[model samples]
Target: MQNEPLAYRMRPQTIDEIAGQQHVIGKDTALYKMIMNGHVPSMLLYGDPGVGKTSLAFAIAGTTKLPFIALNATKAGKKDVEDVVADARISGKVILFLDEIHRFNKLQQDTLLPHVENGSIILIGATTENPFHDVNPAIRSRCGEIKQLKRLTTEDVDVLLKRALEDPDKGLGKTPIKITDDQRLKIADASNGDARKALTLLESTVFASFEENGVTVVENGTLDSLIDRVGVFGDKKGSHFYNLLSALQKSVRGSDTDAALYYLAHLLENGDLVAVSRRLLVMSYEDIGLANPAAGPQVLAAIQSAERLGLPEARIPLANAVVLMCLSEKSNSAYVALDKAISSIHSGKTGEIPSHLKDTHYSGAKELGHGGYVYPHDHKIGTFGGWVNQTYLPDNLIGTRFYDPIDAGEEKRLSAIYNKLEKFKKEK
Candidate 1:
């Protein structure tokens, strides 16, 4: 135990000892009562990395005094699952803790369904992704409940740090290490609510400080060095990645330039340029389409520039694009119209193309009545108008208008031209 990493050594042995996540494990909660009764149900634990999902699973095992079996979905195969199920069937009381459950494929997940349903094994699946999007719905249905663990607050992280410093058995309590309250808080803030990361940072800093002078007192400089090495509060591949991306896009959609830039910086700092570029491109079309016709092209150009320049230089163009996207007139008419049209198609709202709209360039087309197509150029009216009314859609969709332009950006001008076209066709 003394040789183990501080994070692992300091893992809480009971639910009450776990930090944060009171919403799920607090006394008097259904989950608490369930654990206390030793009637642990199969559950899915969802949250960002390092917020104590695994710890909670261990705590539950301790509370029930059941045999705990741990497996990582990333490495565990169908055979391993079968073995666990076999053991559970004989043992009668086994807790199967599967980490990174999102990595389990359909077949792998299905392997556990029978065992879970028959109550041979109590399964605790943990994942950082949204279970709805990542988990097999069949497996998800079998899980008695899905509980989300919230990110730890600064105060919660501080408590863990203090406990680590004072625990003589599993922590640095044997060492004469001294960390100021401000230093501890700084480390907690730097950890970004991840207790494992905070403890690891503290452990590493203590070693470094002790090595320097034989006295373990972490100074500001030593703490700063460790914090820099640990990077930021959130993992780029975890839920934080999607959350920040969502916030960035929403900020841009809401026309909050400051917020947009702030989220942009967060992504850029995390070195996720490709995701940032892809999202910006999407926003150009989905959120700002037809509002500023130039927005789409301008964003494309910015992405191209960023790709060519890279890094600090790339950020300039990306920043410019983010600002422009936020400030541009917003419109989702095109996106909404496309979806509406697709929905109609999916609902069997389609019909054969009008004869005149069929291909006329092919052989024997005239015999098929394809040559009767009217040319607008032949009916020229004004400088811009060789206008003529014609059946451009299927017979059933002839009058089914889908593109409704919003009265914002260049769409307003487009709406006038469309209204005029409608009037001309009506008159004819």
Candidate 2:
């Protein structure tokens, strides 16, 4: 008999045989019922590789007893999809499983839409990429999406390892090597919630044990050797994302260029690059405003460039912008000014615009004495001092200054304005 790959050989023959994905395949779930009742919606299963998406697709096909047609979208195109749909229609019942569905271009994906809608073939798309960004909207809209959660917890991996070790027909039950709790836990840690990887690592380690112990027992050294060779990245979830991001943002806010660069590296390594770019853009406004007013536009420009170029190349511009934002002189005057203005308005402390400042756009406004305003341009001083009339600020903050400019490049001009406003207020 020809040998199948370990992944295929260990495939779950039934829903019960499937490990994890309890949210979708658990008892009485929509997916479970659909598989059991032959009403499975055309679905797009998205997750990192080795997380049971493809296995689930196969198990569902087997349970429904449908003629399963598999396609790797990387190699297939519009003509290939149309041929598959045409042949499947003749077969009466077919479930088309498209692996790496994101690889299919718009034209290729469009060919499958009519067949999916008409029920000629129930499409089951499996993708490793995030569906929101990778898949075309039209193709994605047609399929019900289920995210396959990454294998991260020890408990989930433990169950999977036990199953692989126990199943004689499918797994390495025939192997003489025995696994201890520590070995299993370490393997689980190494796999990082990826079951396929765990199994592969397990198989290799067991083979190593056989080589060393002569088909009788497995030792810790064998497991350790396997673990040493395997790499594991900790799960980036919950507070890790927010806490680390807060530090990065604060470093930039504090204008510590070195500290900001370190935090940027941490964010790039542990967090989403896109998320990092977004937070940096906000910090440009909240921390670097007016003092280096150009920081905000630079960050925005980097964001646009990053989207167009994607990672690696995108990383260069994003990193450059991040460093520039950190080194830029800090000022929150604009943010502070807006906050006070908003607070005053919220407290019902705002007044009508001075009649001189009111709109003169209409003839009726002019008739109502709206255009009887002194033109600042028409004055020799070209400044607004006596032009002020009715108060818009509250009693407690009538002349309360908010925007105090730093001695940074462009902000010196604003500092001059602040000085002029101060002198004018004193004269009044």
Candidate 3:
């Protein structure tokens, strides 16, 4: 057990050890309450890689003292699930943690449905993919709750790094290692929200350095060498990879065609197709927006082609998407309007839904004055239009506006329609 990798040895024994996921594992949350009460349900843990899915499963089992058996879905077949079922039958309920549960075929997943349904097997399916889109619906619905875990922030990773260094039993407390606060934080930042990466780099950096008279010293450039293993972050300074991505987005948004291409070339040279594809797709909507509505679909098509092609062949389509984004008419109105609406919600400017808009589908809803909603389709004022004015907002905010469409691209037409709607609203 002591010879295991640092990340494996440092698995969180309880929810308290898992950082940056207070939404699920917080003391006041329903999941935490259930765990403390010794009633953990079968659940699907979904998130990016290294985001504590398996750690959470281990923490739950440890807290409840349940038998935990982990099996990778990619390698585990129907027989493996049956073996776990046999164990469950002989020794009471067991926690079956299925890593990469999305990879299991329908038949393999179906084999465990009966055991999971009978309460003999407590299923904990962990996957980096979204279960809603990837998993079999039968398996998804059987899992009572789906918990989403997020990547640890730099600060959170730094905290974990400190704990790993200080713990005497499970960590390197006995080792005479000297690492400064900023040096530790540098490893955390380079980790890119992965706790495993931070700890692994710390272990590697500590071991790679020559031992001085008494201690292993982690100097300024120690972590830089470790980060250089991945080609995308070869920014000499060790932190310019994300900065380069930001420069690409800003250049496209500013309509600097040459600068956008320059950044794109540099990012391409790093061989990070996933990163490049993500930035292009975001730029299509966030920069070009409704001004060039077609830009989104065009960029998506180009990206799909690039992904299918891969690498040097992929760069051609990626460059096309970048050039189109740089030249497309720009507008941020779509997301800006959404941001204003979100701000209003946060500021407590919301009121109860108007009586007409309230749900009338339930029993006895009409008796409570919930079916007063007027159908606009029934009151047509023109042959081509079935428009009737109705107040969607509450009475307190009848005139409050959230969307202010700019006169750019297709929004010019949308702006004219918006004015007409407002005119009819005032008359009503």
TM-score of 3: 0.64
Q: In candidate 2, where is summed lDDT lowest over 10 consecutive residues?
A: 231-240
Measured on C-alpha atoms, candidate 1 has an lDDT of: 0.89
Clashes of 3: 0
lDDT (10s digit) by residue, model 2, range 291-376: 88888898999888987887667777888887898777878888888897788679877665666667888778867777556554
Residue-level lDDT tens digits of model 3 in 1-428: 66888888888998778777889888889999999998989999987667788889999999999898999999998899889999899979999999988887877777788999999999999877768777888889889999888778898899889988988789888888888998899888878777777778888888888789888888777668887763332342122456578999999999999999988987888778888898899989988888899999999999999999998999899899999988888888888889998999999999878989999999999888886778888887655367778878988887888888888888788788878878987886
Give TM-scores for every candidate, taking all chains together and pairing residue i with residue i. 0.89, 0.61, 0.64
List where candidate 1 sits over 4 angstroms from the true fold. 77-91, 104-113, 210-215, 232-243, 362-364, 372-374, 377-386
What stretches of model 3 exceed 4 Å from their correct place? 230-328, 331-406, 409-428
The window of 10 residues in a row where model 3 has the poorest summed lDDT is 230-239
Which residue runs does candidate 2 get wrong by more than 4 Å? 1-3, 145-152, 210-216, 232-428
Error of 3 at 98 (Å): 0.1
Which prediction has more favorable TM-score, 1 or 2?
A: 1
Please give, for residues 1-428, the per-residue lDDT of candidate 1 as tens digits. 88899999999998889899999999968999988987999999998878999999999988888989999999999999999988887898689999988888777777888888888888899999999888778778879889999989999999999999999999988887878999999999999888899999999988888443555778889889889898665667777788899999999999999999999988988888898899999999999999898999999999999999999899999999999999999899888989999999999999998888788887999887776788888998766668788878897887898888888989899888888888887887
